[model samples]
Target: MNGMSRIVKKVTQLLVSIIFMYGVYIVTHGHLTPGGGFAGGAIIVGAFALIILAYGSDALKLHKEEAGSSASESLSILMVLILAVIGFFVGGMVFFNNYLPTGVVGELISAGTVPLYNIFIGMEVAAALLTIFIALVIFKEESK
Candidate 1:
């Protein structure tokens, strides 16, 4: 009653998972590919936005999602900071010094700590974006 047509809702439901997976793939293979945390996170948030647009904010539980996304953003940033500090300590006070071993040239696990950074950054970006979207939705509703 609060959203689009049934066909739109069904299509959104089907595409959301695929979009999320593609985003994850982009983030994971960022070192090897062009897409990275920021791009992938934006892609993931597109799925969230699509769901809200197709099914309404209530269907997505905006408040709960906002809280969860905020928490995830915080946790991910903290983790990134911790990783940077650890890198600094382990690499003779050099910040973000890739201390982990680089396996192969074109392999999945070749980049070592870079992949971890990408993952954490992806989480942070995605959560931040979702939180922003939720806040915008709530603000729009309140203003009306």
Candidate 2:
């Protein structure tokens, strides 16, 4: 009742998984391709936004989403920072140094620590954006 038409909701249900998967692909293959963590994160959030728009805020557990996204954002940023700090003690004694072994060029695992960074960055960006969106939704409801 609060959301859009049934057709739109159905379409969203069908497309959400595909969109989410595409975003994950972009994040994972970022080092090999042009799209990276930031782009992928935006795409991932777009999927969630589409769902919310199609189903309305009442259909989803908004408070849980807010809490989860906030926690995810915090944890991901902490992991990223930890990875950076580890470089000082591990490889080159410099921040963000790649300590992991590199693989063959053009391979999926060739980027060493770069992929890890991308994954965490994608998580952080997605969670942060989701949290912002949730806050905006809450504010809008409160204002009304």
Candidate 3:
């Protein structure tokens, strides 16, 4: 899809970076902050959706991105599962146990497994949302 007016496209380009950065920040700081993987991932996906709106579906070539998103989602889910399994085996604990060291308070890496889980969840959520958006766009285009 062709892009919108030059002004809208330029504005979207500038805002997209800022939005993406905010999402990363939210995901990374989830353990210390109020927002976590889900919120941050949604924000990131929202930024992508904004781009799609500004520059139409065809311009983004979402088919390629859809595959990447699917892969990312699968990998993230696998990593989460692996982390849980490892935690169980190492400590003879239940799944999703926190086996790693808890660092200093108010620090970025303080929460041990929580932060890692948040990161993986963020990736999974972002990829899933992107895939959904791409599918919706494709369906819409096809129906038209």
Candidate 4:
């Protein structure tokens, strides 16, 4: 697939960073805000989608032999599970327990494990969606 016109590429270049930044903001502030990991991840994926739309699948630069997105998704899932398991040993608690100190309310660092979990979840979701998007793009190209 070929990329769009120069104008589309320029517009996408201008907007992608802003969209990505908003996704990061949503992920980081999930504990105190309405939008959480899933929403933030979707937003990040949308940013990448915008790039793909403007520049085509080749813009991703993903090699055929490497499964980078899947690996990232797996690693993030493992990290989240490890964090949960650590809570069991450290606090003598069950799964999904919050062991870290909860600081002042309405603060960035107040939610302890919640923010950590959200970050991991965001990474996992973003990677998963990107992988799917790339796979679909590849399939579409191959079927032609």
Candidate 5:
């Protein structure tokens, strides 16, 4: 990478990290705070997008190639679906049900399905983002 690209890349990485951490903070405290699963998931991937823009196509080589990333992203989606189904079965009623007790507000373990959904969504978003980044980056490589 060029030197200016490297500096810009580092700054982007830093910003992305900060954004991801903020996402987590909002998600984890979603019950007491404003954000939740969807917000966190979207914001987390927002960070990934910055990474892609900053470092160019080669930045996410830490993960496998696009096909593997595709599989991983699919797996995370399937997992979320499976978990929701399992929750329904276990709850003996609604899908994505909060089977667990909704404890006091502001506690880590408070909102039941809220936290669970947040976690599943966060993971799914992260993996799917990686898949997307890998696909886009790999395309740039092939075009050369």
Candidate 6:
């Protein structure tokens, strides 16, 4: 049983790592293309979920029981709010105004606020998923 579990863990971990990298790529290229924060972030968590399923709770540890995740979630929300407030002062009272420069078309710093917004959304999604995982893990443990 132990050997079987170890093998399964390794396979699932490899798959999760691959999908996580792919999600990062997609989020980075969000504004330039279609897939944005919500999609890419969800993909990342989906990969992580697969890993958690195959492995155990120990593999998902980040330090102090989901500390990084909670912090990251707050940071992302803060950033989004800050940007919106900046928009109020800079880009008039419009909906998600393109405050920053649009830059070139296919560049890293293009798409004005789109990329930034996508990044925050991605962070939030990733953190939220981690929180959910932690909650579920605790709930199951308590039930056991």
Best by lDDT: 2
Q: Scored by CA lDDT, what does every candidate get?
A: 0.92, 0.93, 0.91, 0.90, 0.71, 0.81
State the TM-score for model 1.
0.96
Worst 10 residues of 3 by lDDT: 56-65
Q: Which lDDT tens digits does candidate 6 get at residues 28-135? A: 899878898999988888886776677666666634658878888999999998888888888678756788877888888887888888989998998898788878
74-133 per-residue lDDT for model 4 (tens digits)? 999999999999988887668888999999999999877999999999999999999898
Candidate 4 backbone collisions, by pair: none
Estimated TM-score for each candidate: 0.96, 0.97, 0.94, 0.94, 0.73, 0.84
Clashing pairs in 3: 1-58, 1-59
Cα RMSD to the true fold for all candidates? 0.9, 0.8, 1.3, 1.6, 3.0, 2.4
**CA error at residue 47 for candidate 5, angstroms:** 3.1
| Cand. 1 Cα-lDDT | 0.92
Q: How much does candidate 3 score in TM-score?
A: 0.94
**How do these models rank on lDDT, best leading?**
2, 1, 3, 4, 6, 5
On the 0 to 100 scale, the lDDT of residue 42 in model 5 is 74
TM-score of 4: 0.94
Tens-digit lDDT track of model 3 for 1-144? 377888999999789999999999999999887999999999999998998899987667778888999999999999999999999988766888889999999987787799999999999999999999899988988998
Q: Which candidate is the best by TM-score?
A: 2
Candidate 3 positional error at 3, Å: 2.4
Candidate with better lDDT, 3 vs 6: 3
Off by over 4 Å in 5: 1-7, 62-68
User: Candidate 1 or 5, higher TM-score?
Assistant: 1
List the pairs of residues colliding in candidate 5: none
